[model samples]
Target: MTRAKSGKSGKSGKSSRKSSISEKPSITADSSTAAKPSITSKSSSDKPWPYAAGYDNTPEVLEPAPLTVKGTIPPWLEGALYRSGPGYEIQKGGRVSYRSRYTSNDLRERYKKAEAITGVTFCQRDPCKTAFQKFFTTFKMAAFGGPKMGGTDTNVAVIPTINFPGLMDDPDYKKKKGKAGPRNLVMTTDGNALQELDPITLEPLRLFSYGAIDDSLNASNLAPAHPCVDPDTNEYFTVLLTFGPTALYKVVRIRQSIKGPEYEPDLDVLAEITSPRPTYMHSFCMTKRYVVVCHWQCDFAASGVSVLWYGNAWESFKSHDPNVKASFYVVDRHQGRHVATFEADPYYAFHTINSFDDDGDIVLDIAAYKDHTVIGDYYIENLRNETGGKPPQQAMLRRYRLRNIAEQAALSYGKKGQPQPVPAQIDFQLDESVNFELPSINPSRYLRNYRYAYGVNRSGMNKTLIYDRIIKVDLDKIKSGAKHSSSATFWMEDQCTPSEPVFVPTPNSTEEDDGVLLSIVLDGRRRTGFMLILDAKTMKEIARAEMPEGTVAPHNFHGVYVPNSVAA
Candidate 1:
């Protein structure tokens, strides 16, 4: 978590899964002919992209619909043939680079233009690109490490701390060669590291991957449940891991001999909680006695479905009985185990979780749906198979309280040893007629210390959204959020193009007054990513710092603005 002020920067945010568990050949091209490669036409040695489809098959046959999805994409929405979907969809589909061939070529070309204008920025954005690096935000985090999933050999394997969107080749680059796009996992010891392993055996083919980590730290395993750091001692602990649909709610803990480089644990499970439904968590929270979870329902074009999750209400998201609808839950730890539970089904789902300010309240964002049909696929089918569920009818942002969650829990399940969850006593007593609105939701304090919280919602061109805004109870303001929605009211606020905000020390400033909320925004233009500063109190924009073009947006995960403490 070191900061490289002006030149390049650091702070690692990571997530991953065992996609190949073995390295697939980087490209089908011959070594000598590797100099000039084209993504436009499929090659004999080139493997087709997954989002592009049928990776194991020849690229030609898959070509028929790579750019034209008649039935899948609507006629008006046909623009999707080449356009990207919401940020969450891109993350779920594991899309690091824009859609392959088209992206490869476009990126390279864009790089040249940005270079002529901004110079070197992201990874290799050119010298003048310094303004956009947001030197404070570059500290990239990596999930666990281990052998490559496909290609190379049949046996040799080695783990390398995986960094999502690793070493980006400026989005402006023109015609990027295969195996040469944004996103990657490299060796922790050196920047330019690789794992050329044997495909047959999950073993490394070289010595570059000696000191790597593994699946335990895998980010994609579930929510980026922010790791815990002891404020009194600067010691960092990785926690709140997810196993498919279940949240490993405070299951286990990791300890070490020293503070930084001297010790790196092989991530141990600290706590565990099962999601009732097959879910993928995005953000979660931890109280002294409970772990709050948010559910994820991404419409990765691959699956064509959207989702809504309430806390870690896993079982609720699933239509286990066909009579089920979406609901939220709270897992309570009275002594040392998951002692109690409660839930609510107001037909809503969650995407992010956080602490009210940095003091007490448990806060989260919920999405409301219109004419929603739920398709629940529990696992990843082959590329050719469309196993993903259907998305919600439409999504609207909502708000809720975590502290009040206890009463909700009391009314959600039966006693400790009960078989099926039953309505608790409290749920029957509360009046369901009043509407609650949040006045102003402040995330700067908690966000200042916690690097990855869904601080604001995005709503403008569309309806109302929380992705780009900060909402509170008593202040109704989602795009379509109404004062009479029968839910919590959220105060609408705006942030630059940044999501997943992190805290950093002031530029050239000392550590004592550090905790600043920092978010990077890629203007969706030819320029580099921009930095948006926010006040921790009101959760309002304080400044919109400009960075040069050709910069990179954070990959689809959370990041830490670690100061150059002992974390190196």
Candidate 2:
């Protein structure tokens, strides 16, 4: 980690232009020969600008530089805020290939069979190129244009630039069959690996697997994009989804510590739970004592089968089954045991807000959707007004209260001595009117009963999928059925979009909402980006960190704020 002293001081509400730093070479890849769909901006002046189209054209790598500040950065505010997402876009006719030096004969045979099934040839001349070529070929064929591939009309076949560092040199690399190697960064929807960037510069550093540095940590098949951090212990908790004869979910805890001069984090597997089917889960919930994994009816096997045949993971999804019930797998954080499996009404959720124990019952709040249409609706092409398609199903703020969590776990045995599922009641439409996603809360309130939840809401006459407003919800009042329970909303300029809001608590703050909400806002009309800082309490703009002219920050899904002490 690198540290630099703060520059000359500037007053609040005034723009300050800092001297630019010397440019450093950026890590970037160019593959424009692949078959990707072209995006053209709409010509009509009456319509809102197509922001999603530009999403795929942003720069792949950014250099470390000073950003212009519109207002004074809180003098006490000291930390590196990190954001992660797909920085590079696979444009039309863009070709990308990957190779691994440690490929085995068995993998070669499997690749041959997969190629035969999809009629796509893998680069056999270079074993190092085979894995990525096969992966990208399947991805493009399934997502771009192919018979039997659904949603090909949307043209949303963008591949995240996933970089794996130092795997080729590992002597044991070939021994790990079908296991994802250690990566410095993985920016995909499936969460195979994580990428660490310079917290201050947001420059690509390297890719790493979940347990890259810890030998005691068990390898995970897939990693979650959103990992919850415990405010008290500063330990990060996330789930790793694995599949074989049966699907298994493991909850892992990661903690950072100083080893001499470098920061080394240790990883530990907290608990592993079984799922009957392979489910596509994007996020999970963590409480003080339990880690909750929700298995929706949305199964990955339904799509994985197609990848086996057609070579695309996105092509494997089946329609949502209303009759199928969603299952909640709760694991005891301390004992690392499966405490209970509770069932609730069928629904699909991409993100979870918070979960905690309320009088022996587990309460989980999520952005619940009617079905899986939201998955396809996120395609950049699908958000165009010319598509004339109905808006994707909005995820309503829903809460599920599982009664007798401990009691059900104790009496889980059935009459036949088999474990039976527990029942839970769910409450939907707590506010009825507010529909949003990408939720966040103050880090200190994580794993505890939180009062306020912040998230992004979309609005405009065009009704596109762009996020136009940031909303803060009062959980207590909303649960009480009080009218106008929403605390506040910070609306952006027309056509300007904001990414997910991350809450950074003020130093030694006692109040829950006494923090700052940080988000990267993209001015689509101007084709530029900036960081928007808002007062968590009043939802008012405190400052804005403007990017250099012509620098565009691509849309990001999630971000984290590491305080100065932790960052150093």
Candidate 3:
């Protein structure tokens, strides 16, 4: 993000011109080549700028960070600016060496400016650094996206979730209940990992129980996949909820009127879409009239396993026909009807829906082929059909755009320019380890209409290239589709695995900054989590609140941005 003309930019510009930019390198000439200078510094007709680039030792500063609320930065936050090296990258995870203290006080004004956008009320919360709650489930599939919900006021609703149990034979008189953080619920198979507690107070929301879906679960064929929310009608929905290897395929519609602060039970199943085989649907977004689901066609590596279902490969699977046309599903959430199924050719234009990053940007999962594993080389069709491509050896991020992809695919089929995709400027950065994972994105466009994106870097190293920085993208940029841009900024502290950051732009009133964001950071070795406050415009780290002792699930399925008035 570039600085505005008024403050930071102007000051930085003048300081840069006056300063002697280059630092005489404390260099030990490795060879005689350096001893014998090739020519002179004036070789070029125009001498390099006096401040030509070099390691300045001085902190490369962005505008002074906007101020955070007085209580925003917690004591647990490790300061920024560390000496790069050793004690940095540890086994369980990297150890934070340096940290940044609260410096810039302008955040208050910046935040106040941002607050001008929203017409809502919210609490000035000092978020806690812990997974407020955790639920275990038995479903074995590719991934668990953060949860989705809708409604407002004291009356709200959510798709409470938990990890699916494993081979453990623990049953209850009834079903155990837990709420996912939208995309909550991790199937760890370890009983101890489940946190059956109240999200708000961290008390026991319910007892974590496990058992068969039912005596008739085998015949019932159900799986609680993507539970969604309808804001317009204040209803919650999901595909069929089944038991056993909890990986369900057939799509059945379920819904209920969201009850405000009441003991309301889950909604009822209203419709069904029987597929030829199990077609896994990952994250779901929405349009004015329909829900957009990332339709995944694959034979799960852990399908029927009592132990490893949905835990296997996601990069390559082959269908009966390598190419019949694969695409995304725009289904009607109200009536459960398929509005339009659109597919993009892999060879042409395409973007696998990625999740959100720290700055509220999209962290796209690039190609069908993952390079990290044995099955890495396979492309999307091969991953779907089973036989194709070579694994790149672990997952790698692929850069793509919707417009370029749609146009490419259109031309491949002899159709062009009819209607090209105006993608938000969401580009994928190439990393060596872990193919970029998709993040959860909120569809609401306050103004420019940014495509919210998220991603988690599984690389163990703390390097910014390999990771050490969590990314967030906007839809406006995604639609703008800049092939390469630095706008998709990052949010990360030393050695912390950010589950997924939630963007909460403060409302218009007696506020402070351009916008403020809240996020959870799951620190690996520390066995804890923390809440982070960030500057929306610059994507700079603002403040942090450390979570209590506990290894919260390393990641989250999803999270929500709750406004104030109803937070009670």
Candidate 4:
């Protein structure tokens, strides 16, 4: 086993900027290197931005190596902050460390022989180049039950076993029933397969499907990368899209405990939604009473059956239709039925911030885009381009209110062959200039009314690289009034791009912003990574935990912070 020796922490100089929130600080150099840290505002040069380093495949750090702590780590903060874009940082007893192992070793090897791979991936093209070759390969794979979905690259989001005793046998189930976060970490992608990992060592334990949880359901190809969890109920919710003669979207729910024997199938099919043309859904929203499943304008060609012919998800999507408005299917959680279907202007979104029941109305907040251009912009080749290829189209924080949902359902649903789509009111829209994505909020306020939201600002990053700063937005302030300058606060460093800022609340804190934001920042100049700790309220740097020597924590997507008791 490899062990990391404790190294001395370094301090950084405070920014001379007036506002505390948007300060650009510089890190002090360690004795090992004499390089001075500086910030860059322009990217006119033709050189490839170091930010592209994030796209490169990173080696696994399976051992728990101690990280060099630069400042005070909160005494109460202890546990594993599991990042599902493939890594995790464990902070306990004032010492910080990490272990990373993406469950795609086999997939990476296949990419080496790219043309030899058989699976259909989101952005990757089919190995069969020509028309005849594609037809032959797709026919063979679909006929022989070969891989169809984006298999085993479970690097999008990390879901913890918050509920579902059948998923894992926890000895202290009663004590931590609804009070804790995830006990066992599960890695998920935009596919059907779920990868289970040993929480401590980050080792791939087993590969299974939704069928494993319930025998009635077939392991569908398409599923939501981000599953919704009711923090209050401790129940988990996920939608499985099974494509066949008739495409069916089954919203499954798993509760805290099963009534029958241990490990017996515990999945409850909450609602089976039938759609002739199903749009691709990356994430969904869940409130106390309803689950909001929004299908954007990015519909699959031939009702998703063409995926077998094209053998590529992105290729299978029909061109965006401006006339087709995005639809939101509201499922009644308690009654296990579809309550109403609401429609908004055509848009695409990869992540939904939160949803809640406001009296009779179901309010939903999401990071939405105008079209599906954002999907192809993330191709590895474009990101690593010397001149920073095509600039990424940003997502605006949009709010859709399904007003008087019960009344709309009564008037429209079940009245005809297919119910007319109810118009969802556009309550609020964040400024078009502010580009936000990979949103995170206080988990406690997930299914309730919340004020603050943290995410990476990709506004002008195309010229430089990926996301260069972390942003905090006041949702209530935006709804009450509108000002891009006053409503949002940002924390940034020169040439240092941060990942998704995850808000970790202080224990027993009443204030929603009374917590710290944790993000893995890639310092482009030094070619290294560090765990950035920011004061959530003031948006100031609380501390920095530097990773082991030679380790660069590559850019990642969604992550979850597990408290000590549950993580252990």
After TM-score superposition, what is the CA distance of residue 469 in candidate 3 from its true location, in Å?
1.1
How would you encode candidate 1's per-residue C-alpha lDDT over 1-568 as one tens digit per residue? 1111111112211212111121111221112322322223222444322121111211111011111111121111101111011111011221211211111112223334544312111121221122112110111111122343222211111122322211222222112212322122221111112333111111232322111233333442222323333343323332233333333333333333244323343233433555444443333444444544433332111110111121112222333233443333344434333433434443433233333322333444434332123222111121113222221123444444434444444544454442233332210111122221111122233323332222434334322111334332222222244443332322233222344454443445443223344454444333233345554434455554343343333212232321212111
- Considering summed lDDT, which 10 consecutive residues are worst modelled in model 2? 18-27
Per-candidate count of clashing residue pairs (backbone under 3 Å)? 115, 21, 113, 0
Query: What's the candidate order when arranged by decreasing lDDT?
Result: 4, 2, 3, 1
TM-score of each: 0.40, 0.71, 0.45, 0.82
TM-score for candidate 3, please give it.
Answer: 0.45
State how far residue 390 of model 1 sits from its true place (Å): 15
Q: Candidate 4 on 1-568: residue-level lDDT in tens?
A: 1111111112212211100000000011111322322223224664336675454334544455567888888988877676644344545557776655444444434544553445554544533121111111122222113443233332223344432333644445324333344444565655665655544444444555565566565446567767887766567788878766566788888763455222343468888888776667778988999988888877778767777677667777888889887888888898887878888889999889889999999999899999986776665555555553666678988888998878866775566533567789988888866678889888788889999999988657435445887999998778778786689999988878898898999989999999999898887766678889999999999888887655666666656776666622
Against the hidden true structure, what lDDT does model 2 obtain?
0.53
In model 1, the Cα lDDT at residue 238 comes to 29
Which is the better candidate, 2 or 4, if ranked by lDDT?
Answer: 4
The top-ranked prediction according to lDDT is 4
The regions of model 4 sitting more than 4 angstroms off are 1-48, 86-90, 109-116, 125-183, 244-246, 258-265, 412-418
RMSD of each: 17.2, 11.7, 20.6, 10.0
Which of the two candidates, 1 or 2, achieves a greater TM-score against the reference? 2
Per-residue lDDT of candidate 2, residues 54-163 (tens digit): 34333333323445567655666654443443221111222111111111122233434554323322112221221122222222231222332221111111122222
